[model samples]
Target: MTEAQRQIFVFMIYALIMVNFSGSSHGGAVSSEEEADRITSLPGQPKVYFQQFSGYVTVNKAVGRALFYWLTESAHSPLSKPLVVWLNGGPGCSSVAYGASEEIGPFRINKTASGLYLNKFSWNTEANLLFLETPAGVGFSYSNRSSDLFDTGDRRTAKESLEFLIQWLDRFPRYKGREVYLTGESYAGHYVPQLANEIMAYNANSKHRIALKGIMVGNAVTDNYYDNLGTVTYWWSHAMISDKTYRQLINTCDFKRQKESDECESLYSYAMDQEFGNIDQYNIYAPPCNNSDGSTFTRRNMRLPHRSHRIFRQISGYDPCTEKYAETYYNRPDVQKALHANKTRIPYKWTACSEVLNRNWNDTDVSILPIYRKMIAGGLRVWVFSGDVDSVVPVTATRYSLAQLKLTTKIPWYPWYVKKQVGGWTEVYEGLTFATVRGAGHEVPLFKPRAALMLFKSFLRGQPLPKS
Candidate 1:
């Protein structure tokens, strides 16, 4: 069958299952009050008024594959708030590591690496946040079938994620049919859209449908070619790379193909050498972590527990060493027991990124623009935001990719304000919206918490960023 036919066939199969599967078969009447999953209090965690839950939801029973999740209800009226599913993209990264521990989650790891502090700007303030460690082999998530670790990619990830959501809903029936917003950053550019598509496809034939209302991605890798080209331009424009190397990168590299020619690779290496040079590529403008023991590789590799320390620079009231603290906190026996994690005593330590899974990523779509197009055409709210200083998947790349969609403008580009200061520029299109977070990096919330929170609140409300 052609690719289109194959997709249709797959959709039909899922549709048939959705049509026939009785809610009772999946235990849809299961009580939402999961007292066992409730997290009373985490070690070193501060007192909080909200409820928290963390555990594994088996996505594939035959393979014994399960994904770990941490859910934090809103500080106020959590049941009334929308359910926001947050994903972190490394194709192998753990959302709990970065999304929860450092960025928008309720707590930040203390410098002692054994304690936690409240993150005043946590996204849960606006919505119930659910951070997942997806696709198995990621963080505390795992698979009984060892091969599943090496055999994974976007499609498998999306498929398992859908199953996870369905099973998760069965567990938290209160959230059933609630408006759900899918949001993530980095490689999740692929995860969020693909999963949204799956949910939409499944909803077509199901009586109990997921109320997927909108999606938001930050500094996302939407189109590989644009992302690569934009990175080169960002480096050159910021004077991080020499003009000569910049020219070589633009002229020699063919990002359309996954593999670059040896000549292109050489030029790219030179460009990277000039640009990185002890600087964190994720945040070009931020200071480098001075106390590096080389324990963290970077935010991208944060999922791997055994990977190097994160290159964190103290800025904007954010802890540079938060990942180290998270590493320490999660590994504590008491903490794990409190969170209901590591039940089977997996052999490997939890990491931020899975090197094995990363190496074995089976498929990557060159561009998720088509998926975005389909989602927007389906009338689902679509928003893309970028941190101005992120070199990994800079705002320039997002601009170029969105331009390719040729969306009509609903609101002309304008500056968005927060606390009487310019947060960023924003523009609304017929089917999508784009915004930038000034002075932020790949992880916007970690770098510019206030601005990121403002942006997020607006996105969740389906409103434009504040004009005044």
Candidate 2:
């Protein structure tokens, strides 16, 4: 062949190679970077039909801070599904350990950490699930600047998370302008609303706005005064504590203050240690994880450090040792390699919650109600749900906090059904909806998987909970 002909043939071959390299190995539309992040399969994970991607997204270049994320696309019609961002809050919890592994994502790590099993009620059936380990100190997400861990607070966390999302979307530009919902539990009540507020602010300035449609938080921490009062009431009403202890908790504990007084601290310690002994505070009725030595990791328990001595507690329909399983599984060298995590090899074991960051979380808004009011008025779908059996951030606390909103009732309180059973009760107000999952714990999905999945489906469709 002539030189000209040979050159033309070489160009054609290069173009073909480029096409093959740019597209996903599995023939889906994905960037080379995305393909690199894709998990062919996790260690001992059950054979799954859907695709999974996980890795880090750098949020702050100056500090070398990066956040880890796991994307579990829907098992069916993934491209057509909307995106749901799930955050599990300890103000320092790893969403991967709690949300992705236990609550909403498709897989549940076996007790032995030997293999994985499919969760029949995983939320990914209805939406693309993205679990993020936010800020700089939690899970595999880390920072070169150790001070970042100590200086962590609501403001910085929100800012960094917004940065993470913006950069993450750029990395997976396919999701730009897609319907997005922010959902979480516990302290995520704070993280969800704060992040939503930031997203709104970002949209106002940027041309490529995030399509943030709604937010759903469960057993969340809302108003401080109301939460404190309501928690005491719940303890008394549920018979968790005696009448005399309840009165002392009510009178001595300064609910209005951000920091508890010495007397208040003593009273709380008394109630927890003396009265409520060795119980799973996250789930009032559920058995504690068999491996647990009585310490629980939670936001409410964060304050009372005496009672909350450790991290990685577990509960629910499945074996109670799941957290231990996750701890063992994620820390495995092979598991980390498969996930593309711990690339920096930071010097710390992977715990479900970060003790350092949880203790040092600097600023917290006493009330998230203002953000709720703003989002509600902004025409965003806002839903606050509670697990009735959770004592930490109980149903009563959620009720009291929401009652302060004074939203007009759009739908009266009613029982919502799932599989012809009374799954939960729900009330739709003018701008918000409040629901309680019957017998669910702090981690709603872990305790009531069917009901939580149904709740999620209804939320995504912007439909009311099934009345029948």
Q: Name the best candidate (by lDDT).
A: 2
Badly placed stretches (over 4 Å) of model 2 are 1-29, 292-301, 304-317
TM-scores of all predicted structures: 0.89, 0.91
lDDT of 2 by residue, 1-468 (tens): 996666456556644644664564433466677879999899898766677899999888987999999999887666678999998888788999999998998999987898899999999999999999987889899999999899888898899899999988877876887899999999898899999999999998999899999999999989888887888899999998999999887877778887777877777778777888777777878876553565543322354211122322334445566777888999999999999999989999987778789888788887889999999988899999999998888899899999999999989999999999999999999989899999998899998999999999998888999999
Candidate 1, position 309, lDDT: 19
Q: Write the per-residue lDDT of candidate 1 for residues 1-468, one digit (tens) a residue.
A: 896666456556644543454364444543544657889899888877677898989988897998999999887666578999999987687788899988999998787867788999999889999998888999899999999888788888999999999988878876887899999998898899999999999999899899999999998888877777777788788888888888887887786767678887677666555455766677776665444665433443332111111223222224555566666778889989999999989888877767788777777787899999899989999999999988767898889888999988999999999999999999999989999999898899998999999999999888999999
* Residue 407 alpha-carbon offset, candidate 2, angstroms: 0.2
Question: RMSD per prediction, one decimal?
Answer: 10.3, 7.6
Model 2 residue 78 lDDT score: 65
Question: Could you tell me which 10 consecutive residues in candidate 2 have the lowest summed lDDT?
Answer: 304-313
